[model samples]
Target: MSTSIRSIKSLVPLLDRVLVQRIKAEAKTASGIFLPESTVKDLNEAKVLAVGPGGLDREGKRVPMGVQAGDRVLIPTFGGSPVKVGEDEYQLFRDSDILAKINE
Candidate 1:
């Protein structure tokens, strides 16, 4: 688990919801030149911090979520509700809203 996750374990998402922390944008160029904040692009990649228990189906059976905590996932360019815990910034997204899992 990531350090950021450890600090916010108390947050338990509900009913297929997921908590995610975005991967930081690069602050330097490949040539070692420092880039200004204005040049930094917000990435669509993020680390899963917490996952809610699977939701119930029509038959009352639990439908498991595709992703889990500790997984790196790809998110949409726009959407997801931003969350703030202390100085950290997190986002809440529905399991289906997550685009894909990043294998690394």
Candidate 2:
């Protein structure tokens, strides 16, 4: 099973939302301890890849999603649906799963 998969640009979720590829955990801890992959859960930071068409407003207009592809965002730890991309685990959630937009 290969974890290396192609880009996620193919999946454009509905309602002006999208999927993101969570970033990997940092290798070092605050105390400078190196951690292995098995010790970590899902990493919180992610980059948006795919987005949906804007949601419809009561006035019959499209309300655009707040975030776009390539945006770095902070995701809630408890949010989102888990999915398998290739051989690795990824998450599928609406734009709401994102807690904050990372400036960097």
Candidate 3:
């Protein structure tokens, strides 16, 4: 593994937050044609790297998290906190902010 990935995994989120790595948009089309950077649109898909412990509920009970580490999920287009680990960039989102867990 690269040093950056190892470095990033060292960070553990706390209190219902999740750490994820955004899946990059394809730079090439299905036809094998290379596209310019300007033409590439960012994808909302991400891979869960680490997740915090479940958050507390209003009744003081522990709420289970919707997603777990290593799950593929769809994230919102905006509003996640940006994080940089070594040379890689990751995003931190609330477990609730994750749109959905991808079946694939």
**Predictions ranked by lDDT, top down?**
3, 1, 2
Q: Give one digit per residue, the lDDT tens place, for model 3 in 1-104.
A: 22344588688888899999999988999999999999999899999999999788999887888999999999999999988766788899999999999998
Among all windows of 10 consecutive residues in model 1, the one with the lowest summed lDDT is 1-10
Q: Which pairs, if any, clash in model 1? A: none
- Indicate the TM-score of model 3: 0.88
Candidate 2: where are CA atoms >4 Å away?
1-7, 28-34
* lDDT tens digits by residue: candidate 1, 1-104: 12344457788899889999999888999889999999999999999999999788899887899999999999998888887766888899999999999998
Clashing residue pairs, backbone N/CA/C < 3 A, model 2: none
Instruction: List where candidate 1 sits over 4 angstroms from the true fold.
Output: 1-7
Global lDDT of model 1? 0.88
For each of the candidates, the C-alpha root-mean-square deviation to the true structure, in angstroms, is 4.2, 3.5, 3.5
Best by lDDT: 3
Cα TM-score of candidate 2? 0.74
Report every candidate's CA lDDT: 0.88, 0.74, 0.90
lDDT against true structure, model 3: 0.90
